[model samples]
Target: MVDNPKESAGRCAQVAGWLTAACQAGHTLLSEPEAKAVLQAYGIPIVETRIALTEDEAVQQAEQLGSPVVLKLLSPTITHKSRMGGVRLVLRTAEEVRQAYRAVAEAAERQAGAGQMQGVTVQPMVTLEGYKLIVGSFCDPQFGPVLLFGSGGRLVEVRRDTALALPPLTTTLARRLLERTRIFTALQHGAAGLPAVDLAALERLLVRFSLLIVEQPLIRECDINPVLAAGDHLLALDARIVLHSIDVPEIALPRLAIRPYPSHYLEN
Candidate 1:
């Protein structure tokens, strides 16, 4: 997104530090909030999330954000929160927030045992008016960076509607990736009285996704699912980032099966 050099450098340091810390701790999976931080720093829009360490704190945070926010258990050991009943949605009042907090607390305890339970994450509940799409990439042992885009949300695995493209995507390349998907037709034309989503916005995110993978090879894999594409808005509702181990130095680029198109040579 054309950030200045200073901003870019700060982002580099922050992301590198997070990756390093996680690898040093012998962890590959970053918590949702942690992954969102990396995405936000890279200019990808995400719902700002806050952590509540206690029941009262959860209620207060929920009240401040107003009614109908979401509360999910936060734990380094638990990633599939929904599967573990650690997610509470559409909570409307202080009492509801308190109850939800306790519910997720129990869930976390059950999943991770006693002292392993962490706090809960609080984020405003945003309505899904348009398509919930997934934008992500992985370091392919052969192709280097491979980008992915498709239907997200609960139907992700069941539907299996997705497309892949090599990294360093231009607007044209991004559009081509989207077109390969089955839902792209419906996304382009109004379907079942629903209007088409903003293709330009999705294309922009796709391009940014490619650049993110290009610049930050430490990100071994990433998934920004349910990126709510309502009108012109593209906010990542949830993200998961997996980092390369510390054995792979952040400065060294992973060997790619194919040499990337050297666009930098055109500049200087």
Candidate 2:
């Protein structure tokens, strides 16, 4: 669970008090937006996105992103976009954008009914080399926040090679976390002369994500699947977070004020 120290400290204090009250009231979960906002505050790089209520606003946002954008229906009522064709990609023109937006909205409305509709999200397209990375967290019944990192994208569920770590991860542990993955050997020195990824940056992302889970106990599961590495910079292109019941136990979350990530680890 991670939070922005300055911005969230007050909220955390408030939530702490709320949790105490909720415990007394017999309540246990937090809402989805609340979980997402908390994670975003913790420095997890979510994609550049905007919630648009009207078609005109969606077109404006798509144009601003410079065409070739992705649009998806944003409804808590519906979970699987692929199943319902609620996602549209590679939209290059304003006409195409409008069509995509209307299509998704209509689909969501039809499938989930009118009140379940909550507009759409227009996001920028991310380019990448090699494979996508996924970082996820799940609150284990006994252990609390358990973080997982792995190869992702459409084939993530099929491949299923990944690594796991506990909270408050150190730099060394971060490196080891990558190594434990089956794809590490290929990523380090893979076919066709692909340069090694910035392991240090990857570590930082992992540590930061872990910290995010520690800080936001309201989050039941958070997944950044397909964190694309384009050249040197990494970008999280897609994400999903599930909120937990507010009644979840209040554990002492881990802190992430470690030394700056080692510069040398990325040089090689």
Regions of candidate 1 where Cα sits further than 4 Å from its true position: 1-10, 25-27, 249-253, 257-268
Residue runs of model 2 more than 4 Å from their true location after superposition: 1-40, 247-268
Residues 1-268, model 1: lDDT tens digits: 3546566667778877877788898887888888998888777899978888899999988988877899988887776678889889999999999999888888777777887557898999997677888888887766777788998886799999999888778889889999999989878885766688889888888887777787777788898888887767789998888888777764565654445465444432
lDDT of 2: 0.68
lDDT of 1 at 135: 87
Clashing pairs in 1: none
- lDDT by residue (tens digit), candidate 2, 65-101: 8878888777755655656878899899999989998
Counting clashing residue pairs in each candidate, in order, gives: 0, 13
lDDT of 1: 0.82
Using lDDT as the measure, the top candidate is 1
Q: How many clashing pairs in candidate 1? A: 0
